[model samples]
Target chain A: MANLSIRSVSKSYGAVSVLDDVSVEVEEGSFVVLLGPSGCGKSTLLHAIAGLNPIDSGTIVIGDRNVTNLPARERDVAMVFQSYALYPTMSVAENIAFPLKMRGLDRKTSDEKVVAVAKLLQIEPLLGRKPRELSGGQRQRVAIGRALVRDPRLFLFDEPLSNLDAALRTELRAEIKRLHQSIRRTMVYVTHDQTEALTLADKIVVLKAGRIEQIGTPLSLYDDPDNAFVAGFIGTPRMNFLRATVADGGKTLHAGEASVDISHLATRLEAGRNVMLGIRPEHLDEKQGVTLSLAVDVTERLGSTSYVHGMLPSGETVVAERREDQPRFGETITLRFLPARTRIFDAQGMRIR
Target chain B: MATAASDPTRHFFQPIIVCLTVASVALTLFVIWISLHDLSLMRAGREKFVGLDNYLRFFGDPRAMAALWRTVLFTTLATVVEIALGLAVVLFLDRDFAMKRLVRTLLLVPIIMTPVVVGLTWRFLFDPATGMANYLLSLAGLSQVDWLGSPQLALYSVLIADIWQWTPFVILLVMAALESAPTDPLNAARVDGAREWQVAWYVLLPMLRRALAIVALIRAIDSIKAFDLFYIMTRGGPALSTETLNYYGYIAAFTNFDISYALAIAIILTIFTNVALLTMYSVLFPKSGER
Candidate 1:
């Protein structure tokens, strides 16, 4: 296992830049996730790190060796593609042993390593089956086994679970986490799924439009976002943004038809200034800091807790979490949230302290 | 739930199926009937039932046996050489290059040409005295060689003409297969620490196996029945070196006017071709249970 450092990496295709001056540092044995929506250059960054893509300007150092100009095979990195990219004509055992065979390992040792990886992946019975005979989930397991058999310096995954069904994705995601815990190898994974990033990553790097938006621990990013985009992208049910203006000499915030006292943050708010109030759904409680009324739109129940999506009197859509009583559609409900739990962004979407 | 007569789709297809069955089955029966008799243009009015005599004579005729051997040799060599050369060319052209579409278009010229034209063109090129082959040989300080006149080189000269015309056909098919094949495995092999050649050998070639086998089968079938190039270029050659079974059947029917023997020869060739191709097809596409 080795640490990887990407310095001033930039890649462009003719006139379009895919990765623009991106840099990331992943500590040895840490699981770092590159998380973002599609077209965010998250996969491009992972490919760059794997030496599959040549960056226009960057020096990538892994274990004190600069691999910026090296080919993928020379970089000692194994990548699990989103498509599972198994050698179609090869059986599971041969697919797993391909890297070792290419490295000129002895036949007996390669066979043993293949068996060990198959056992680790719980695919021992499937070792003789060709890829076409395997199901989608089984194929991915073999793909992971292929990457694991080599024990490369770094493991890279490009949305490895995106192709499976929801249940299989969760199962394999947990298996991948368990595998990482057992091996403790340096791994860099790329995915657009925030939940996967939050569950499996030691550090989640949230990217947007070919640039790094925020890089921090999963909880840190969820609890303290650097910008409105990061705040909205990191959370489930999405963070609600309400346009408001400072009033009462910065002691209160006045949205369209409702006003809430912001005495706790009066120092940070200037009178007559416009800002966006960011609130998490879970942060909106039935009994806390300030009261707000919502004209109910819908309620989505998940057995224990329900998400109450409604329009605030301020004319902005908000989702509030409720535990006890469920509210029906078109019912006005009162919810409260701590002013300290809210995040304020300027009109430009930049966080204001 | 629909009976055959009541089904509209089946009604539309029935005439086509009937026509094809009658065309193939009736023709084959007529050929078999004629093969059983001693029918010849030399004695048109005295035709009589020969009852396997023509078939028995084929086994003893040294010329017929030699022609059958020649046919086998030509078909096997043409198929193997064309597939190998075509695959090599396709691999070279797989990458990006200037005028790639133009080059591909140029490769189609030979495939689209009539075999007769290809035969005549190669015949002119192989002329012993004034041909381009000898002129190039003289430029390289080599002696003039008889490409088609010599009995030893005649069959191979025809084989060359067949190869030149059909290798492009193989290229077109294999290239299409290569383009449609998933590139992910190739990339995976590269990342798996395989060298460029290793990736092509282990990953790319295996992926192209089904396509190559199919092309080989088609080329073999075509080579076995190859007639135009032999007719136009060699015409059974100076000493019968290029006398393939098909050409021998033509000679028996037209030159010798032995229609019954010629029909027998054709029937034998058909049976041989079917058996050989069936064996090839089975080898190329083995059953899953066998695997």
Candidate 2:
């Protein structure tokens, strides 16, 4: 295993830039996840690291070697594609042994390695079957086996579990995490699924529009986001943003008719300036710091917790988590949140620190 | 078990089925009946029932056996050469180049030309004295060679004409297959540490196996029945060197006017072609359970 360092990487296709001044650091034996929505260049950055796609400007160093100009095979990297592209005509055993065969490995050793990989993946029964005969989950296991058998310095996964069903995706997601922990190989995974990123990654690199938004641990990004985008993108039910204006000599914030006291943050607040108040759904409780009345519109009871989605008097939507009580629709409910839990952002969506 | 009375779609298909059965089965039976009779165009009214006499005569006829052997040789050579050359050309043209569209359009010229036209053109080019082949030989300071005049070279000259006209047809179909194939496996192969040549040989070619087999099947059937070129270029040749079974059948019917023998020969060629093609088809496309 080797640590990978991407320094000031950038790529473009004709007039459109796909990866713009992006850089990431992956520690040895750590799982680094590139998380972003579709077309956000997370996959492009992963491909650039794999040397599958050349970057316009960057120096990618794996361990101590600069692999910027090296081809994919020469860089000693193995990639699992989103489509699970197993060679269709080859049996599962042959597919797993292909890289070894290409490197001129002898048949006896190659067969032994293929058997070992098949056993590790729990696909021993599927070794003689062609790719078309297997299910999607089985095919993905074969693909992973192919990559794993090579034991390359780095493993790149380009949304490998996205094509499976929801239950299979979860199963394989856990299997991948367990595999990484046992093998201790440096892996870079790319996906748009926040839950996958949160559960699997040692560090998450959040990207937006071809640029890195925040690079931090999963909890670090969840608990303290760098901007409104990160704060909203990282959590379920999304973080509610209320447009508010500073009033009363920077001591209070007002949105429509509802107002909250911000005397603790008055030093950073400027009077008569527009700001956004960001609050997580779980932060608002029945018994807490500051009370705010909401007109309940709907309540979703998910066994242990219920999410109360309501409209504020200020004409903003807010979702609050309730552990026991379920509020009636069209009724006004009072929910409170600690003032410290509320994140303040400027009009441009950047955090105010 | 839906009956025709209950299935409305069968009403539309019944007439087509009847027509096909009548056209194919009736004509074939008529040919078989004629093959069993001793009929000659010179004495058409006095035809006699000969049973299997014509079929038994074929076993002892050295000329007919040699013609049959020639047909087998020509079909195997043309089909194998065309497929190999076509696949190579398609792989070479798989890349991008400036004028690729123009080159592809130019390649279609030979495929669209009539077989008669291709035959006549190649005949002119193979002419011994004033032909382009001999002229080029002279330019290279090589001795003039008889392309279609010698007993040994006449069949091969016709084979070259057949390859020229049909290889593009193979190229066109294989190119279409190549374009439609998913590129993910090829890229996966590259990342699996395969070199460029290995990528094509191990991944790309195997993916294209079905298309190549289909094209080979078509070329084989056409080569077995190849007649227009041999008729136009050589007419059974300087020493009957280019007399394929199909061409010999034509000579028997039209030249010697032995109508029943020619029908018998045609029936034998048909049976031979069907057995050969069926074996080839089964080998290429095995049962679904087998690899």
Candidate 3:
């Protein structure tokens, strides 16, 4: 396995920049996820790592080699495309064994490796079938088999499970994580799905408008995001941000009529300073010290837990998880925020620390 | 997209199709009947039923045999050269450029021109003494070569004219296929360690197989029935060297006053074309049931 290092990479199409000055380093044998919305250039970064896309002025290094000028075939990398880009005319075994054949491997060895990869992917039964005859999940297995058979320095996956159904996506997502754990290869996966990033990545490089927003571990990004974008992008049900003004010598937060005790904050606060108080849904419970009354707008029941989307006394919307009860719509529900769970950001969307 | 109703016999034919079918069937049956007799327009009403004599005469005639072989050679050469040259041009123009649209529009000029007009223009260009071809040869310090006058070079001259006109047709269709082909597979091949040439030879060209086959089929059929160019440029040539099956049949009826024999050749050419096309279709598409 090899570490992928990208330095000051920038790419543009005519007037529009697809990837701005971006730099990220992925540790060897670690799963690095590039997460972003559409048009955010996460796929571009993944392509650059695989040498499928050329950077404008950046250097790409894989292991100890500077692969910035190398073609994709010489880069010692294999990629699984978003559409599972299987060779449609080839049988499953041939598709999986293409890289080995291209490298001039003999028939007996290639066949052995193909059989091994097929068994590893649980696709041995589909060895003789064409890609067109396989389902999306099976096609994806063939794609992954193709990449895994090469024993390359790095493996890049560009949303390989996005085309599958919801059930298949979850199954394949978990299987990919398991495969990563077993093989311990340096893999860079790109996806817009936050759950996939949180579950599959050891480190997620959140991107926005072709720039890196934050790069941290899954829990670190979810618990301590660097900006309002990362704070909002991570986690299900999203985090709520309320505009609050520091008061009482930075001891309290005044957001309209809603007040919060901010004395336990990690960052020193000054009086009259404006900041955004970020709170996750699960952190807002019914039995915390600092209590606030909110008018329920809607309650989304997700079986074991219910999300009470409501407006605080300050007229700002907040989402709180009701573990033991589901609040009725249009009714006032009392929710509490733990002071330690609150993250504060300044007006420019940067973390308050 | 039109499907017949549950009753298998009803076709729901449009009036135009109904008229076309009746005309085609009647003409075909009349042609077959005429091929069995000596129905000469110059000697009307003195005709006698000849049965299989005309067919036997056509097979045994040396001129007819040479014409058939010449047709096959010209058709094979014209179709293969047009496709190969057109593919090269398409590959050259596949990338984006400032004047690409104008260039593509200009390519349609050759295909849109009438074959008779194209043939006439080439006839002038092939004129031995005052042709542009000879002028270029003289400028290059080479002797003025007879383009159409020499029997050896006459067929190839017509073949060149045909290639110049129809290669653009192939280019237009193949270029469209190249444009519409998904680029993801190509990129995937490269990322999977395939070189550029390998990618095209192994993946890209195979994807264009059906389109190329259809174009070859069309060009082959067109070349087999090509008579206007031969009539306009050479009129069966200085030594009948450029005479193809279609033109020879025309000459048989119009020049030799052998109507029955000409019809026999026509019938034979039709059967030959159908069987050849069917064979080609099966060969090109071995697993068509999957598609």
Candidate 4:
């Protein structure tokens, strides 16, 4: 196990800066996931950590040693590429043993190590087959086995499950989690998939563009997002937002067709200001506190639970969760949100309590 | 049905088309008949039908056997050298460098030049008394060796010219293959901790096997029938050292006036070339289960 410290890492391609002054500390044996959308530089950060890409400015310390200038082979880390870059010519056994061979291990010791890794990865029967001869899932295991046989200080995975189908992704996600538990090695995984980050990571580092948006556990980010971007990006079927002006009605919000009773946020409310109001679908009740009459537009029924897409008379579209026996499309329905579940974003898209 | 007949768009027999097919088949049969007319002259023109007489005489004659051996030796040696040098140049030019296109164009000068012109140019350079090659060797205080005059060295001199002319062809084709080589496998090999030599030896060479095999097979067939260089340089001579099978067949038909023997050699050579091509194909494209 090893701890990793990245200090003010920066990268640029000629003139375009990709990562800027980013720093993070990964504790020993921690599973840290870097989550973001496309071109957010998450994969670049992972590659920088794996020493596959050189950072223009930074010191990367691993296990009390500075490895900033070390080549990838000497950095004592193993990376699983999204493409599962298994050597096409080598059999599964030879591919696994390649790193060990580079380290000057004798044939006997390396073969034993390969066999052990194959057994652990459940790829023993595939030892004699080439990469082209195997299916996608089997090829992934061979790649994992190659990484495992190295026994490096850190494991870096760059969207290793992205190439797999949905069901296979789920299966392999569990397998990776189990492997982490058994090995307990420090890992830095990069993915744009929020679900994978939420399920597998001890800490998730959400990024936007070239900056870190927030870093926390899954529930922490879900319950208390720092900004509108994090709030919108972290959930499925997404949180719904309503555009309206905030005005003082004694101790409650007075805006839109209906005044959302926000007496709970009276201390934080400012009079006569435009703000964005957000509420998650799961937190909305079909009929009940701060009420808005909705003209139902579309209802998506997923057996036992459903999503209702509707609009206020003011033409503000919103999605609300409902049971199967909910209102049909083109009908009038009333939905409400608990005052506690509502989130307020000021004019600049900054979160406000 | 009566209206269909009145349409005049249907014919029971298309007379003009029938004439065309008969004309085409007649033309083909006429060509074959004229080509085989002299074949009977070699077959003894009797019921005897001495099956393998000319073929046996071709193999039995010492001068012809010598030509056969020389052709085999020259073709094998020249093809090997051409492929080896060609692959090296291709690998070198495949990298990013200044003047790459210019250099490649310059290298292609020999390949695109007429073979007879290349041979003529070298023949003048190998002239023992006045050629620049002998002058340069003499400047180095080395004794002047006969390049085209000696039976022993004439074939070697011709081979040098052929290699200079055709090795660029190998370079061009192999360069195309090298440029399109997949980047993923090379990157994977680097991550898997292979050194530069290992990457080239273990990864790249295997990928190039098919391309190199194709180059070798094509060059082999081309070199076996090689004539223009030998005709322009040594004229199959000093004492027939560079006389290949083609040259031998030409000499038999024209110089010795043994037209029947020459035709027999031509048939044998055709069969030999076909067998070589088949063998190369099998070697390159093996069964699925066999590696």
What are the candidates' interface root-mean-square deviations?
Answer: 1.9, 1.6, 1.1, 2.4
The number of the candidate with the highest TM-score is 3
lDDT of each: 0.91, 0.91, 0.90, 0.83
lDDT of 4 by residue, A175-242 (tens): 99999999999989999999999999998888888688888889988888878888888887688877
Model 4 pairs whose backbones collide: none
Docking class of 4: acceptable
In candidate 1, stretches whose alpha carbon ends up further than 4 angstroms from where it belongs are A247-252, A258-270, B1-19, B127-146, B289-291
lDDT per residue as tens, model 2, A237-314: 899898989888887877666567787763567789999988899988847567788999999999999999999877
Candidate 3 pairs with clashing backbones: none
Per residue, candidate 4 scores C-alpha lDDT tens digits across B155-226 of: 999999989998988998888887777755665566666776777777787778778888998899998899
Off by over 4 Å in 4: A244-246, A249-255, A258-274, A286-288, A323-325, A346-353, B1-53, B60-66, B93-168, B175-181, B232-234, B237-239, B267-286, B289-291
Q: Give the candidates in order of lDDT, highest first.
A: 2, 1, 3, 4
What is candidate 2's TM-score for chain B alone?
0.96
Off by over 4 Å in 3: B1-11, B14-22
- Model 2 misplacement above 4 A: A248-251, A261-267, B1-8, B96-103, B127-143, B289-291
lDDT of 3 by residue, A1-353 (tens): 44888889999987889899899888899999999998899998888888778888888999999999999999999899988888776889988988998899999999999999999999999999998899999999999999999899999999898899999999999999999999999999999999999999999999999999999999999988999999999988899898989999888987766678877777778899999988899988847567778899999999999999888877788889989988898899778877778888999999975
What ranking emerges by DockQ with the best candidate at the front? 3, 2, 1, 4
lDDT of 1 by residue, B144-257 (tens): 989999999999988888899999999999999999999878878878899889999999998898999999999999998888889999899879999999999999999999
Each candidate's number of clashing pairs is 0, 0, 0, 0
